[model samples]
Target: MNPLHRVGLATARHPWRTIAAWILVLVALGGLAATLGGELRDNWNVPDTRAQHGVDQLREHFPDAGGSSAQVVLHDDARLDAAVVDEVVAELEGSEHVTTVTPRLSEDGDTALLYVRYDVPTTDTDIYGIVDPLWEAAEPAEEAGYQVELGGELPGTATEIEGRGELIGILVALALLVIAFGSVVAAGLPIAVAVGGLVAGSSGVMLLAGLMDVSTSAPTIATMVGLGVGIDYALLIVTRHVARLRAGDTPVEAAARATATAGRSVVGAGLTVLVSLMGLRLAGLPTYDAFGFATAISVVCVMAAALTLVPALCALAGRRLMPRKVRRLDTSSPSGSDYSTTERGSSTTDDTWTARWVATVARKPVAWALVALTVLLALGAPALGMRTWPQDGGSDPKDSTTRAAYDLITDEFGPGANGPITLVADLDEVSPGEVEALHREVADLDEVASSTPVSTSPDGRLAVWDIEPTTSPIDEDTTVFLDELRADVLPDGVEATGYTPILGDISELLQERLWLVVGFVVLVSIVLLTVMFRSIVVPLKAAAMNLLSIAAAYGVLTLVFQHGWGSALLGVDHAIPVSSWVPILMFAVLFGLSMDYEVFLLSAVRDDWLDTGDAKGSVVRGIASTGRVISVAAAIMVAVFLGFATESAVVVKMLGVGLAVAVALDATVVRMILVPATMTLLGKWNWWLPGRSSAARQLDDELDVTPTPTH
Candidate 1:
């Protein structure tokens, strides 16, 4: 008669009504998304950073130079004819929102970069609409035997997800489900629930975009997270329901009981994920906010579907949620009304394998715990070497137009051509002589590749210079150069902003704030876990183990993406610095997800410990009950996350790999070895609370099971 049980019972009793309600909700939301959703735009504003202030100053003071610029790289083996240059300029200048097209030829005149300035910012224009026209306008140059590649705001601003990656991931998940459940119908239930939840979640994001800023990347990231959690949540509830059916409970009774237990854990796990995402907002970037909002909305919908829809569908499917093999073993099962609680965790109960494994670990708690700690620590070693920067368009696939443009420009102008820093000076505070002196000094720096003559505003309130760095945008050398410019070169009134500096500021800011995020999440999460389980040691232990899993995951990310170890297989051809935002974002997300698995396992262990005071025996039985489910659930998540690694975006690819690695290690090493061994070592002390230790032990003393249930 718990709330979860009541909702589950009501849904199961009125299965068709619940199904219809979900259908209506989906259809209405999907239609609204198709009609009212706003487009996604990149919000790279890093508050309180010099780059952000410089951008604001530029936009406010220098109207002509304020607009975002795109590049049209024209390469020719022969001398570039004036006529071809004029034609390309005229073509681009005529496009919508194009304010001007300024062409600069290389010293040899064999290559040129056309700075196509737009009247509006990149976010304000129809990006793809303008891109197609730019391509068409440059077609004449290509026809005249000039190789033209458009970069900057053209393809650089577009965020496209690879549909194939998700498709293949779902197919793989289906295969795994079938193998686990041994029935296509049973396998399909989790898939159906996940897809349904994803649709609702994605649509919700689109609708929210109409109300708030949502990045194009958010929905995809949300989809990736939703799919894994969705299937895992549904799997937990469905498995419990099937077990109830085998115990001679009717469909409604089975659904209610399953929801009472596994559904409660699903809710807890889902809420933990949502709470952790709140840390992203503390990051102080709309990009991070969009990510948090989209993913949080997604998790809510999926959790709701798992709690309500899973029960409704179970009732509709009746005994079909179980495999044919499972049904064959359930003789004289209740048809529609009987209720039974033959055994807790009968749903995920595995064979002698899990029991034996638990026994083996419990027998040598110290050794097993030490071995797991060592493995996690070893895997986490590489994280110490991880370096982060915002992944530039240079990291795109070679076939991409942005990459092509980047290469052509770099080859012609120098590495600095791809990473120009803008110098913004307040004319009201600085005289013309001072401005010229500043430009001259900056141009004379060894790291400065080239500096354009200072462009002063017509009203004489601002002066700007386009200064190119000798190194690439993500280069460590460029970071030092920027630091030197800010600390040693630039005067008080002058500030820096542009492709290189903005990304540099973002990297610097995110890295500085990373500790703040980590501290906030860890502290808050420990409190939540303690409140949820009512044990100080349990939450603290879970936190420590979660850190080990996350650290190990970071190490894998550093090796694969940063060190280029097997990065090519993940589809990123060369080693690139980790994305500036990846570590903070990864910590926030994975910490929550790691805690999710912890809750799944610990919830069961706690429930069993409460029922039986025998700590070691509870650990053994808990593993036997939940080990198979946790392993299978982790397998499903690994497959899903790995699927997203095939995405074209470097950030998405890195996230996919990192999430997959963390879940894999969390389920196997942390859950299997560490949790059981540590819990056994702690024994009755594991349940000790500030004021309830004596009472908890007195409530029950005939206890001995201790493996946490991983529903």
Candidate 2:
């Protein structure tokens, strides 16, 4: 027996032991994670960039003023309040991690900013903690008719979602599962297995956090992936086990066979996901590293749970997992001896609605293929004009302190004050007079609103200045302004880094490296697919189709978020660039997920081909056999991802929406209609692979050699 078969059999034979062991593991890991896991923080390590180099110097020479800073904006159009502003400064100085609070008044005299520097970097500190004191201190000003808001990273920071999205997703999955299986016991088993695996996987990621700089969004993103794939994996296993039991196999026997087939698919899908995510390491960002770790670990743990726990759960549930009409399983039937022939519980007849639909699509392969391609291409066309920027607080809701601060700053001081360029210079290398000359030159530029005089360090080896632009922080003009200044004006010794430069660098880097990432991911995935399915044509076609799916998702994101078409319905009021990291993230995630449907469909199709030797018939049969399960799985994924869409973070919402749209398209149009039509068109060529026997290879060669044929 294969490893998957052995695992399934082992778990099923000792169901209670398996369940107890899984629970023990979950509890132990949960306890350890809660007690010892490292804290989650936002760390964007864009090393070797101009901004990074400049920031490094500031940290070196001007430690007091160098680290991450926030501004406490006290604005009142009515007039000034000195006592209240001084109280705010005094209160800020007492907060934990606060190093120095430098107070400055705007030229308009109606606005005041207490530039509060923290000893720690923004990545390591709790932004809300910093704001808590500011918020409390600002009460006096607010009572005196002044608008008080926390500006900078404090207000715009994307905090972790409080599990509401995951809970909603799970509830939806439960409802759908009940509808799909028509058995509450069956519906709940998949959820149980998925949640158990998720707990273990999340705990593992928590442990991983101790050794790495985990991003705050890592857990939320990981949970999103875990719920979607975990539930889907369990659903596949449960579906197969039900079919096996109805075919008259004993519960234990059925569980083993289900694991061998569906469990194999789970492993393959998880590996593809992992492999695609491995390309994220190529992006060379520490945040991606943490994200990859969290998500990859979730896949591994959930896959293991599906492979092991699902069978045990199935054995425990027994006949109840079967539909109500078929609950009385007869294990004495002769067909029960053979697992391969009992692919699904029911026989597929030409009269069935699903079968008729498959045949209808199969008959006109070219037309269906063209229509599917046209729709996918049209949906993805908007991606070509996508504009990418890093997440900004300025886009937040007006009620948020960050946005309020942004508006107040823009109104009183100018749009440029919201995001000022920080210039750092080594005073030892270039004299203070030269620094002043550079500032004057910069101030005279069209983009410049004003440039502050350089603030030299106590030792006189370093100087830093705040340069305000005339444009808003999120404005494309600000990005252009920064780039032009960097390339033409800023000398080697002088370095510049701030919101605009940092956004420009991240966007430029990700955009430039996007092709390399795509090439590596696609090439590796194709190789893996070829090895698994033993068909060059199948793997190549799958790759192309998955690319289409990803592109379509990008198009939807561009149209909704970037173009601001219907964005207001999603809580965003105006146009904003797609988060720079989101595209690469979507590519890695969607490619693997889309391939899942491909894997399941191809596996079933190849099985029918080996049995009946009729390519067209096999394509139709494959769809008839796997189409319902694929649709249900994709629907679950879509609902789960959409649940995450309710999150307030721009990046999180973008990811949720993109994943949902792509999966919706992939499972419906691409997998059901497009793949079947293409298979029908290709005929026997679909199974063509070199250096292989006519007989099927075992799953992963490890590849399943046994043909899983259905009646």
Candidate 3:
């Protein structure tokens, strides 16, 4: 027996022991994670870039300059501004986390901005704890008829937007399952397996956090992947087990067969997803690596549960796992044979909608292929115009303090002041004349709105200059200014560091390594598909189709988010560049998900082809048999991903909408329309091999004969 079947049989024979062991593991891991897990934080490093070099220098030589800063905005009548701002400053100075607070007044004297510097980075979890004092201090200003808003990374990090997305997604998946299976037990089994796996998987990530630097977003992304794939994997096994029981196998036998058959597909789909996620390591970014590894853990947990826990449930539940009507349909067939085989034998123009659809496609395969290809190409065209950058305070929720502060800064100061590039210079190696000349050169740049005079460090070895741009932090013009500073304007000893330059470097690095990562993921997928489908053409077609689906998703993101085509519908009122990491991460995820459907559909087709030598018949039969399950799985995944679109973070929203669109497109357009039509065109050639068929070689060797085979 194969490994998958072996696992199922072992679990079936000792269901209680298996169930107990999983439960014990979940409890132990949960306890360990809660007690010992390390804190998760955001990674802002763009390695080997000028910004990074500057950061390193600042940390080593000028540690105070590297500390995080926040803005406290107090708007009141002209008379109270100066006094109230001073009082607030005094109130903030008492906190140990507060290093300095400096106040600046607007020209009209109606506003006061207190620049609060902290000894730690804004992402430090401890900073969040200290923010409560700042808020309490601002309360007196609010009572004094002044509007006080705390803005910047620290305040934004503290804005806790409660997420009901997973709960809603689970509810939706549960409803769909009920409708599809027509039995509560069958529908609930997948959910049970999914939840158990998610709990364990999430705990595993928490434990992983203790060992490495994991992103705060890692848990959410892992949950999204875990629930979507876990439920789907369980659904596949459950669906097959139900069908087997209906075909007259006892519960133990049916569960074993389901585990051996559909169980193999689950392993294939899960491994593809795991491999695809693992490819994120090649991106050379910590955020991707953290999320990737965490998500892979979830997929592994769910897949194991589907193989072991799910089968154990089936064996314990017996025939009652299926609804009365479904059992009737299975046993009452005229030939008393399984519906799976009976449906295959039915006419091409049968009552089943999938079979009828396949018949229509078979009649005009080329035309259908053309139509599907054109639609995907058209939808994907907008990706050509996509621009990637990091999101700024402007993309924060409108009601957030960070957004309010961002607006105030943009109004009182130039937009560039919101993200001024910091220029660091080693004065020991430079002369006063060079510093003067550097200021002049920066001031002359077209994108620069203003440049601060150089201030020497206490040791007189380092000097710093703040250059504000004419555009917002994430603006394309900001990148232009950064490029000019790095390539044309900066002196040999000077380096630029700030949000604009840092994000610019990250964008450049992502673009440079994009193809390398894409090639690696595609190559791995090709190998995996070739092994699973046992055909070279199958892998090539599957790869092309998955890429097409991912392209379509990228186009949707570009059109909706980048161009603001339907931003208001999604609650985003302004157009923004897509986040630099979204596309790379989306491609990895979408490619894996698309492969999921490919594995399910193609595996069924291969099985049918092996059963009957008629290629055309197998194509229609396989699609018809697996089509409904594929649709249901895709729908579940779409619903789960779309639920996350409600997230406040722009990057999360991008992932949610993109994944949803890709799954929807892959299921309908790629799987249903393009797959059958293209296979029909290829005919028997779909199974062709370069060398002699393995079966033919084995037969010749067994007969102890060497006969030349002719094509």
Candidate 4:
């Protein structure tokens, strides 16, 4: 019996139950989405340690100092007049949100920059909400001849966040699916599955965020990744079912077999993906940890939908889903071949490349293993010097408006002009002498080019300072300096608060937690693989090989994107430090994707082995039978990732390229070449483990089905 036929039969046995459960799940997810309605903030809000400490220092040193302010650029040239400035300042001060307003002149003498200080911290969501009204109030200033432009990080980030990337991502996904699947209905199926998965995944992320301090970036990551993997997995199963139906199985039979075989493959693959993502929790960075957890949840949901909901839909659609003409086509043999002898018996019985490859492996397993091992080692060499840095502060791609603005700032001012570090401090019982001493200490620091004391709270509990660093804020050295200040400079007398300080602390914490995250992932991978294969040796081999492949991929990324060795050829500028999020994100995504091929290939091999009890023949036949489908699926996935690289964002580009490279490598080198060679080398040992005889027999019984001999 074909796997699709088995799937159809199984589904038929309890159609109502499957349908009812899916409907309930969908309804619950839909309700959650409706209620959440985009209310969640897009990124995590990490408070700034430096800014807090700076604020404290200022309050203790300069009691009369006002609060930190944002310089709003107004368009009207006439607002430069004293009368207009005075009127605008009075109105701003009168506003409930604005604590003080001071107008300053640009060197050009024609523009006025209003320094408006709000009573609340800049991270406060209410400050963002009030911006529109503030803009409205400033409109009269514009009417009086001033143009208003908000220029702070919070305002800029808020605006960008409002321009949600969801719609674009959806359109891209739909278009790709339609083109790849070549049917509106087929494309829609994957989209539907992805939507459900995304909704569920998003809800999971929200719940997690409510419990822990998670980066706002995690949800967007979950949505993007869930959709990509969901659609890819669905395409694999649906296409296989369609092929099976064309092979002359009835709709119900096709659904059953497809689900049983492809469904099983998906389950195994999904587990691999989930486990791989879970590995990211070992990264110890909150951003990566949250990302790993969120993505793992999404992958699980998507897998569930693909294995169950998809099969149910196929069962319901029956023959109607395939066009009448497609259903009528003969599919008893290979679609366009005339080798009668080759087509007879089980699909794996024929002499094929897989057979030839298996014969070679059997004859010279040692030689093949050596060759594969050498190639992997050589490829992974570049990873030794991998550098991790934030990709956010670099110049945007040349064509982007943000990049243009960034360039204007950098060229007119300097490299560090684009991103300034905010230093904040908490003030309690610190004396004025201590406060002044701290200020002078900061001013005299080698990295600190300049410092401006901004405000002192009326209660003298807080003060803020803006520090201009000699290097770009994103520079490693600058980050190091920030770390030193947080760890060594500040004592019980003052507390620092700001994004830079928080980032430094997080970086150090991530370094300490790195090994734990790695250990956790490896342990999980071992357990999951062991359970799935019921063979300790096989799981160990698979994990070792996967680690090698990942190392090679990272090496390539480091060489091209980090060291700037070939970035120009790849159409990117100077490489920034690989974002702190990249390793965990890449590990999870690559691991999951790699597992897709692993399960697909391994399942076929296991099936052939069960039927013939000839290990070599089974390995060859399995590889040959699934290789074409795996290649096509991998190609499509790579295309999707590569398309994402076209975006101007550097982090997104790195992610796209890295993932695409890993998938391609996994599909070809790892899956096709290394896996078979390594398994052949292991020989009978691949199934070595205590109690394995019974487990192997059980797996064989569960997966085994009567092969339909093509005559």
Q: Give RMSD to native, each candidate.
A: 3.0, 2.7, 3.9, 5.8
Stretches of candidate 4 exceeding 4 Å from the true structure: 1-28, 36-38, 42-150, 159-216, 239-248, 278-297, 315-380, 391-393, 397-414, 417-431, 453-464, 483-496, 563-574, 690-711
Best by TM-score: 1
In the range 180-273, model 3's lDDT, one tens digit per residue, is 8788888888999999999899898988888887888888888888999999999998887776665566677667778888887888899889
> Could you arrange the candidates by lDDT from highest to lowest?
1, 2, 3, 4
lDDT of each: 0.83, 0.82, 0.81, 0.63
lDDT (Cα, 0-100) at 606 in candidate 1: 72
TM-score of each: 0.95, 0.94, 0.94, 0.78
| Model 2: per-residue Cα lDDT over 266-331, one tens digit each | 888888888887788777678888888899998888888999999998998888986677655444
lDDT (C-alpha) at residue 502 in model 4: 47
Off by over 4 Å in 1: 34-37, 128-130, 329-349, 696-711
Q: Give the TM-score of candidate 4.
A: 0.78
Q: Which scores better on TM-score, 1 or 2?
A: 1
lDDT for residue 182 in candidate 4, whole number 0-100: 56
How many clashes in each structure?
12, 9, 0, 53
- Model 3 residue 601 CA deviation (Å) reads 0.7
Better of 2 and 3 by lDDT: 2
In the range 569-650, model 4's lDDT, one tens digit per residue, is 5567777676655776777677667767777777767656655567665666677766555765676677667666655566
Model 3 misplacement above 4 A: 77-80, 128-130, 159-161, 327-351, 444-446, 693-711
